[model samples]
Target: MPDQVLELAGVAVLVCDPAGPPVTTTQDALDLIGAAFLGAEVVAVPASRLNEDFFSLGTGFAGEVMQKFVNYRLRLAVLGDISRHLAASSALRALVHESNRAGHVWFLPDLDALEARLTTPT
Candidate 1:
């Protein structure tokens, strides 16, 4: 399936296809960000679509990718459970906590959570 843009909770969201290519590099992330420019205020990517290095903060891939979205003024919602990654790294856990709190980059459990976040008053 191809990626699609949908309106959710009054926000235009570009929901990426899980079957599509994995986001492994900053260039790949930039591609997605560019795609989201089609009237999308947010980009929702499945956790499965992310490269393994994305969860390993030591590689700095996660920070780079996320910074791109922020720099472009686009919100990113990483959709799916990341318990194993969070459990392994204290720094990652802290990052998730802070990111979610900041409302720019969110590591959410699923689409429902993302919708809830969009609908909820901040």
Candidate 2:
């Protein structure tokens, strides 16, 4: 796995590629967030590289990650289209819809959209 800080749309983002199972353990998620928060205003995680499940982090692991997001008051941007996931799970599609409605996280199509969303005034 490779983890590093990257600048996106004038924001420093900590990017990580676990290159294994799609699921990220809560502990690992926390560690990544902690590291990312230091140098970046936002964190972008690639769903494909981390896990193989329908949802990038898997449903169980995603809940834990969401808790961390609340605890840290951090905004998360998940990169890539989730067409594969949408095809696999109706529940996941609903979850993604709810997440977007809440505005704490975003499942964006590409870096440009991600960057624009991050930089645009809320």
Candidate 3:
């Protein structure tokens, strides 16, 4: 499937599919950011599209990728339920919570939630 780009309350969002290459590294994140540069302020990547290392806090993959996104000033919303991953790692759960609270990154359960969050006045 292809990536869908949409405008939610003037915020450009790139809704990516899980069928493509997994985004697990800083370079992968940079590539995704490049795609979003077409006019996207955010990239909504499904949880399934990420590598296993991304969920393992010790791997540092998530941190590296997210840092790249932050450096580029682009927001990221990891779409879908990652309950298993969260349950398995306390660090990751805290990471998700902190990221969501920070407003730059979020691990949401679905696209509807994503749209609602992005559309709401911040």
| Winner on TM-score (1 vs 3) | 1
What lDDT tens digits, residue by residue, belong to model 1 across residues 40-102?
Answer: 999999999999999999999999999999999999999998998999999999999999998
Best by TM-score: 1
Clashing pairs in 1: none
lDDT: the better of candidates 1 and 3: 1
Ranking by TM-score, best first? 1, 3, 2
**Model 2 per-residue lDDT tens digits across residues 1-122:** 57777787777877666463344467766776777767676667776744553264454667777778777877777788678878888887888888766657777777788778767766
TM-scores for all predictions: 0.97, 0.77, 0.93
Candidate 1 Cα outliers beyond 4 Å, as residue runs: none
Q: How many residue pairs clash in each candidate?
A: 0, 5, 0
In the order shown, what is each candidate's alpha-carbon RMSD? 0.8, 3.0, 1.2
Q: What does the lDDT read for residue 1 in candidate 3?
A: 67
Error of 3 at 76 (Å): 0.5
Worst 10-residue stretch by lDDT in candidate 3? 113-122
The candidate scoring highest on lDDT is 1
